[model samples]
Target: MRQLILLCSLPLLVGCATTKTGLAPEDVSAASAKGDDVIWTDAASVEAQCNAALEAGRAVRDTIVRESASDQDVIRGFDNLSLAIDETYGWTQLMFSVHPDKVIREAAQGCEKSLSKFLNDVSLDRALYEAAGGVDGEQLEGLAKRVHEHQMRDFRRSGVSKNEETRARLAELHAEMVELGQSFQKNVLADVRSVKITDAGRLNGLPQDFIDAHAPDDDGTITLTTNYPDFFPIQTYAQDSALRKDLYEQFMQRAYPANGEVLLSLLKKRHEYATLLGYPSWAAYVTEDKMIGSAEATDAFIGQIASIARPRMEADLKLLLKRKQQDDPKADAIQVWDRFYYVGKVREADFGFDSRTVRPYFPYEQVRTGILDLYGELFGLRFVQDKDADVWHESVEAFDVYTGEQHVARFFLDMHPREGKYQHAAMFPIQTGLEDGRMPIAALVCNFPDPSKGDGKALMEHKQVVTYFHEFGHLIHHLLATRGDYVKLAGINVEWDFVEAPSQILEEWAWDTDVLQRFAKHVDTGEPIPAEMVKKMRDAEEFGLGANVMRQVFYTAYSFYLHHRDPTSLVLDDYTDEIFRDFSPYPRFDGSYVYANFGHLIGYSAIYYTYQWSLAISKDLFTRFQSAGLLDPVVAKHYRESILEPGGTRDAADLVRTFLERESNLDAYKKWLTE
Candidate 1:
């Protein structure tokens, strides 16, 4: 998701927009387009073109209002204003992370501030909000009405009806929050840490290739960082308790003290802004715009599941305790670092499977083909890489998405770790689709394994393979899906809670035996992962799953409590320790800044609960796939039309109901948890 709900400019009403919802295809390119052909050779050229478009948008907006443009014309003007800022700024933000040039990155940071201020002004404009007077919403239909209603709703949430002084203050707060959020992410990237493994004995359980990748220090020690590929392998395999503890502490302590104050400050401003917007708290403020409708409702939803899941979580913990006690008679308690360690042991003891067992058959190239081929087979689409296409980095690849003969979108793939790339997996929207011919562009930024590990061939763990499928689910959603009004109803624009359904449903394919056998093959032998092995692996995958789901419950509760309560009472560490300990099956570790590593605390805020909330819906969706057959084109087509294609044009519940032909329930989710 772009997450520019606040940064994006909403439609400013005029008679023009209501009367002329759109232009003829021929008229759009000649009479109305701006900033569509942005050249990226230099920052100066980009800035000048963007500024010109901004000026043009302003002039056209003035004319539309002055001339009392029709409804259709007003919508067009709003779209133009949005595209000018979005097409220019969106690409600039994408380049900031992936572009190799530091100068361009710096320029992007500066431009982001400028764009933030501009967006704040638009959101706070009294004249624009007044022009967009409240409507019964019966006059328009489809995306046009969605855009109209959302525009008015956005203005209200942005405090457009508030007095000028208060509105101005809110605008300032919005700008500050953007800078704080950027700084929060930058701190994480800037604060990388590592520890050296001084003894070979400490690396006893790790794979040879993993050990070989690191250049031994002069003292013959292997240095490892907090990056996922390195960090996860260590936790999954390392036999030495001391070494695991060292790595865990270093990883958990990232972005603290540096981001501690930043997080605190961000929450403060958010509370103030939300307060000014007439909400009692930021949770309420954010929830008003989401499908859940209220903070209390979201809490009740989480509580309902937590009540059923607690005992299941406790049962899973007994297995962890049994394994820990077997390792040492004196080991009565599981520490934070011991969860993965003990879980790995218990998994091997019970299921005869581990990540290392299947890594051989799940090499990088095959995984990519398997995902693309599966999507192509089911969705009637093709993904073609333009090796020569201009991109921000050497590793970044450009590809076009097509449904049969029609090209729908372009996406860039930057799927490996680097010195300063974004550390998580997400689909960044570069440009949004429009009915006016501006095609959508998106980028999938992930820190999946690269050549640094071994042989320059990335072999994903089964979990990583699922992650790949999950993130690409978001990408295909952005590409295959189209909305009439692109701004309000484009890719990943559904309710925050519902956005994960498409991706989570796709993840189930990774666990399916038929799907795995279709493309998962050994790098050396070209043999598909054995059905027997995959079956065991699939069952083993659920080992301790209840505890894992409970962990999400903890994260959601911690975040919700922090935002929904008084900000003055927040002591970042104490609040985390208290709430996190409630759901954690083990004791809290010392000096652990787990909150700092949680990017959602900054971006997701109250919506962290959405992952679990969406998972319930995701599970329900996969039941349809399971019954219909994994590769059934008819079911896939129905999902595309009913779930993925509608975008934000309809409410998420409505979309799900239309797809399932009945109201959704948590029965599938409960079955998943109990199974």
Candidate 2:
């Protein structure tokens, strides 16, 4: 699974030290303590909460504006206001994705629109900007100074100093962008496409457990959905090319026709917003604060990565194309539908491995427990299940994190797919940790195989196991990075491009033999995965490294190019084809509308290159463990303190340097690409 850090652009508001409303400190603490326990019962409840939060936020704004310049009370007032919005709008934004009920999710969307409008207004408030600017950076040190600088920077970026008319229009643009993003995501979530198989023999080469779980319906046809469990198995194992092509088309065209206009309008608005802020394009404006720093630099970095991987990609394509020719003597090129199947065949033929051979040892339940135990041992933390906790779905499980009897954080696992649920794996922040004893809350919404079906084993693929480790890395980042004084500086609030590194680094554990032996046991045989099989798994994993990197480059280019220029005359389909032809190793499958269902096009926008960018840093960071050992507690503790605990208090580059004792470089990434 691609790890998504869902940090909606809402400003991080930390806890306030004092409130001018004359409310007691305990009352302010109580207000900030809302977390996973707050449930939205209906649409009306969402609206009611939005209205209340806006009213209270306005009052806090007034109090901050009244404070004297250079007074510490101004900072407290801003923090109080931050807490108010986070407790209300932040929680609602998360509910919009994972809430089980349709009415509640829709209500949450409505609430998000209202909250976006309020945040836009707050961002443009010249009074608040002036008040924050009055703070003396010379009097502050560390996190406080960093937070003040960020507040000023965001204020300027928001166009708080623009003419009144331009500011009003900017507010309108922000609101529209929020609504369009919600529509784009909802269309993808609500639109779950499927393919029906009439002949059972079409399922040749699939694991028996998968076949058993997907038994035929009353009409003797097996149905497959675009969800990962069904879609991936068929693409990798099904012998019927027509079936694979049909499913691949459906999967790619997820929210088509509906989201077609929605995406274009979003791009147009984003471009206009950037232009209004005196930038040439959205890509230029968005990258200004990231590690890459500029659109030219982003282009250069992508070119560097593509050049490094192209040779390997060409070689990998030759091997896959050769495999395809065995089945079709006249075949000249690999189709998008043929890539997974042919890759699997090549792995088995060359590396003496098949992904299916390891499924029996990785039942869903054991993998979950094994990962929990692994993290607990490495981080000196404990996870205790909260069986009676309130959850949006009965299948959802909640756990509390403790460090030797001190409850430090809470997390929820909604690890299976259903109607109206988020269709991808991501970590949603429910509550931001505060310096004054408030624990953070986060949830992992994923669509893996559910054990409720068939023989109840719910065996997992090696890839899915790696995904689990990746997402848990995000959860652990949010839980451990709680020492910052401001919410914006705390948790996984690092630079947008750097957010995926910690999680990507954790994926290394999934490939380790020692880690797998602890939890990956045959469901029936009661035996651990053999060490030799793991060796084959590791070797087979490298078979498609070049093609995989190129595919990511294709996505990064698609996202960047769509926003780097004017979109009024751009045709979405033509643009997608152009990007694919330039960067992808495989030919584009006709009729596929990849952009319509690309959720990152809304959240990450032009910054989709962050994945590859962060992967480079992750590869460099993992060298610490490669030398010390995968499970070295001393290194883990040092990393937790240096990289995770500081959160966004310091620059991300500084954090990397602190951990590695040198500037981050592409040497590790280049080595991994060709090795």
All models: lDDT? 0.73, 0.81
lDDT of 2 at 597: 93
Candidate 1: residue 230 Cα off by (Å): 6.0
Candidate with maximal lDDT: 2
TM-score of 1: 0.86
Measured against the true structure, the TM-scores of the candidates, in listed sequence, are 0.86, 0.86
- The C-alpha stretches of model 2 lying farther than 4 A from their native spots are 1-36, 39-52, 67-70, 98-110, 176-234, 238-265, 386-396, 416-420, 448-456, 567-578, 589-599
lDDT of 1 by residue, 1-675 (tens): 111011111111111011111122222344223323333667786576556545655665564465466776565555555655655556666666656667666676666556655665666667666656633357867677777787787778878798879978987897799899889989887887899867766788888889788758788878889988888888878888778889899998899878888888999999999988788999898888777899899879878778767887889888788788877788877776777888888889899886677988787777877888898888888899888786667777788877778777788888888876656677766666755456777788877777546796687787778778888887787665566755546655677667777877788888888899888888888888899998888777778787777777887787787889779878887887787666665667788887787777776787777777778888898888889898888999999988888777789999999989999888888888886
- Per-residue lDDT of model 2, residues 369-450, tens digit only: 9999999998999999999997878898999999998888899999998888777677776676766777788888778889
Look at candidate 2 and tell me the lDDT of residue 210: 96
